[model samples]
Target: MALNLFSRKQAEAPPAIEAATLRSDRFRLERQSDWQRLESIVTALEKNRPGRIADDDLLELPVLYRKAASSLAVARETSLDAATLAYLESLVRRAWFQVYGPRTGFLRWLRSFFGGGWSAAVRDLWLDICIALAVMVAGTLVGWLLVAGDNEWYYRLVPDSMAGGRHPGASPEMLAQSLEGTEGAEGLTVFAASLFSNNSGVCILAFALGFAFGIPTLLLLVHNMAMLGAMLWLFHQGGLGFDFAAWLSVHGTTELFAILLAGAAGLHIGRSMAFPGELSIMDAAAASGRRAAVVMVGCVLMLVIAGLLEGYARQLVQTSEARLTIGLVMLAFWLAYFLLMPRRAMGAKVDPA
Candidate 1:
């Protein structure tokens, strides 16, 4: 083609194509299984072909990233490595970061946590409570079957020491002396409250451990359950069964319930990993972790309140009727506020008061 001297010839730069990164340089497949996994992911992604990153798509990244990483390794070792494959790896990573990376603000975190207030927590807690009841029923039935029929199995579910019964070897006077010796009159209330409060914290730790290590959290729960079972069994065996039940009812209603909540939280974390649904294990865990922290914090506050009641009020009062009455009141309050209120009164409204 000839251009006339008066005509301006248009010169256009070639259209820019984004440089493709070579994943082979960064990752290599060490196993055949990894290669197979990558193939599966790539095939699935190509099949589904969502145009852009959405929450639904973001949820799937954990599974995709793991698959792609494994595949990348295999591709590096085999003939599968290429520019297009590298592009796919970058997309998987981008999706991964979207699910887990920190968001913009405090409100974002709060919304992530408790946009629904105690309602969500209570929903989770109720599920846990149902499980706890099942465990208690099973444990109680087993205890009754093992121990003499004369022994009340409820005592086997809750111990005398926790319920406020005398030790077998130690006389009432001796236990009284021991209780008195644990703290001075000046600080005894505070000490007992703090002690019960922190003891409840062990449940929180057990629940939190599910995040770091999945099913192992159950071991912590079982341990606590065993302690409760053993104590109840021993008290019933000692003929102080009724008294023990009455005693535990005071603070045990709250403290033991908190432990159940903890166990539920731990179980939630464990199950998130076990059955991650569309999410990868890591992403599922991260999402579960946010909800779990909120629950665990609530558990801690319950423990503190229980500790104050157990230490200062429960131990010192020593009047079975009074203790039972007070325990019932606190239990009623919790049930009303946490369980009932969330359902009936508190919906989407956030209380500024």
Candidate 2:
């Protein structure tokens, strides 16, 4: 009689819930609702399959997952049965795996760690160096114009301290005598340390001057260039061009490269200030600093290596041609590696910072 009454009342009993409902449970289960909802979703999804999902529809999985998740929570809280819980668990797991579990291994790790915009960072660094080089060339031209034909240009520009009392461009015997005086281990140590300290100090100054928006960097570049040009002219004046070139090139190649790198770093900072792009001046400065730091670290390493080469090899090597060849080769190697190597292989690795 009750069955007949319920059947008859269904026609009059407001439609049963359109969605399934479960009884409330006193105890909470970890992810239990989620698991149940997942299964229910998959079943419903399979029933309503509209062929292959389009790419745009795939992107909506996150939203679908959330909806399933909410419904599952409601079911779990209201005492969903064991079967329901298991189904929800399966659903959540499959969804999660589909979303995140495909890519794995060293390549994935590499992509995550080094995938940021490092190529652009390194390119900007190279650009900064190129601009600095242009500035350096301008300075060189200015110096040449100032004293191009003057006989005393060399005397005025070359510092006495730089030549180590070897004259502006000493003869073979004079060069030999200078080397003989500093050949001992003690003298070598002193000479090496002094040169290292001086060169390193110059590099530091070049880097630090970036705080002034490149004016200081430009000034220092001009000063150094004028001094160098003057010294070269002096060697020519003294008819010791070959000897001086060999002597200076022995280590100057490395030393000068280091200085140029430092100057480039400074210019990078200044350029960031001068042209902030989408960033504020402060933001650009910070970005530039990070890039500059990489170059500066490389520069310091070069300086130390240059110091070692200059200290021991420059003095001991008597043959001018040999020293010149070695110096040129070292310079070429550094230039090719830093200036010509692919960006991805160079500074575009992980932690561009």
Candidate 3:
């Protein structure tokens, strides 16, 4: 009789523990259908297949999420099974990401960036742009004066490889020929590649060197302008100044503007770091960097367009008037796009809804 009583007591102890487990199982069973349905709807939405879910179910998502949240709180208090709790938590997390995360697709982002972001960034940093232009002008004046005073300065300011046999000593006929694309098809290809590569390198260097507080970027801009001045002076001495000007105007307008924008971008970062104003240095730099990057992206595209003009139009368009017209048109287009376009209002919020 004692042994039977002991056995009965042990069995009864299990029933007490099992009763709590039974309640938990019953609770889950009652809610499992709803949970599974919510999970399916969320999964479809997450997979970007919202069409698979009915409109009524879509409307019910918020309600379902709220119920699950309440159930989670109750489950925690009641000491629900770990598996059930984990599944609920995971479901809630996935649903939250679908509801609140960034929904902008690539095409939308691209449109926004090109439509307004680039021009707005440029406008915001207008001060830096002005500074860059000033530096370039100063450099150009210095270079022109130096070469005019001494013909030897031409050799020093312009690289022999870049001048490509056209220098201060070249005769008027030679200089005119140089402007008229005397190079053959293969040579023109090589020249185009070299010009694009060199210009692109300058733009990249200007932007990259901004971290040095902008000094290097300024120097680079000045150097580039000096080269332009030297070349112009050389052609002037040979009596090809007018023709060269027209030829350069075709591509120089776009190319030089791109470089200027790049220099502005670099200087933006440098100035922000040097004078952070109210913000901390890190915060200022971060803000300025984002704005500058947008400008630089547009600048690179401008350079590509300039390269095409230089390579094809400069070679094919024989008349100086035609070249000048093309250059002026491109310059006007860029000016209107960047300067005249209406900008987004400051502190305007991007609607993610």
RMSD, each candidate, Å? 12.6, 12.2, 9.2
Residues 1-353, candidate 3: write the lDDT tens digits. Answer: 22233334434555657776567667777887777778889889878899999999898887787787778888889987566677778877776666555566778766777677778989998999999999999999888998889978888888878888888777888878788853345466676777788789989999989988899999998888888899888887887778888999989999999999999999999999999999999888888887888888888888888887888889888899988999999999999999877675222232232
Per residue, candidate 2 scores C-alpha lDDT tens digits across 50-86 of 3555555556666667665565677677655444455
Residue 121 lDDT, candidate 2, scale 0-100: 38
Q: Model 2, residue 287: what's the lDDT?
A: 78
Tell me the lDDT of model 1 at 63.
67
Error of 1 at 145 (Å): 6.7
Better of 2 and 3 by TM-score: 3
Question: Where does the lowest 10-residue lDDT sum fall in candidate 1?
Answer: 1-10
What's the lDDT for candidate 1? 0.58
Task: State the lDDT of candidate 1 residue by residue for 1-353, as single tens digits.
Answer: 01111011112212231111223333432333343443444445556554543555446556656665566455556644344355446544543444344434666555544444554665755655576556655655454454444344445544565646543444545444433322335776667766765676688677867776545665566555655555566556656555666677777788876777777778777778888999999888877766676677777778878777766666666656777787888878776666554332222222111
* Segments of candidate 2 deviating more than 4 angstroms: 1-123, 141-156, 163-186, 340-342, 345-353
Higher TM-score: candidate 1 or 3?
Answer: 3
Distance from true location, Cα of 351 in model 1, Å: 24
lDDT of model number 3: 0.82
- TM-score, cand. 3: 0.72
